[model samples]
Target: MKKLPHKFQIPLTVAIMLPIMLTAMPAVMLYSTLPKGAALFEPWLDTVTRMVPFALPTLLVIAGSIRFVVTKWLVQPAPSL
Candidate 1:
């Protein structure tokens, strides 16, 4: 399989990860936070709306930082022939 180009990688990763995280995180948190028999729709939507703006840039920055550090310092070069 072909790898995505470097230019496309962060955006693609965010696009995929964001929706999954956004949907799953709030549902789990609300399930625990909301009282039994309480409605979830309004709270869930509210959480999503409130969280997305913060989460996107945070996730993007984290991913980019990790990629930079790993490629810069952690990954070793291929052995010479």
Candidate 2:
């Protein structure tokens, strides 16, 4: 098997993140559709609501930082012939 390229390492990580983004939609929809407004604070639905807003931005920031750093420093400059 061909060893993965160093440049592919970061991109592979970013690509793995795509499925998590896809799952968030259904997760949010399920949260909204559930009749949790009348329920107390300890339910699983409440956890989803509280956690997603707090966590999503943090995730975005982390991923963005990784992308910025890799693009800025890790990628090899084109070799001048």
Which one wins on TM-score? Answer: 1
TM-score result, candidate 1? 0.74
Off by over 4 Å in 2: 1-42, 77-81
lDDT of 2 by residue, 1-81 (tens): 889978798679767875566556556666676775644334545656666786768878997998789879999766889
* Model 1 residue 22 CA deviation in Å: 1.1
Window of ten residues with lowest summed lDDT in model 2: 36-45
Against the true structure, candidate 2 has what lDDT? 0.69
Indicate the residue-level lDDT of 7 in model 2.
72
**Candidate 1 ranges with C-alpha deviation above 4 Å:** 1-14, 77-81
Per-residue error (Å), model 1, residue 38: 0.7
Q: In candidate 1, what residue range of length 10 has the lowest lDDT sum?
A: 9-18
lDDT of 1 at 50: 94
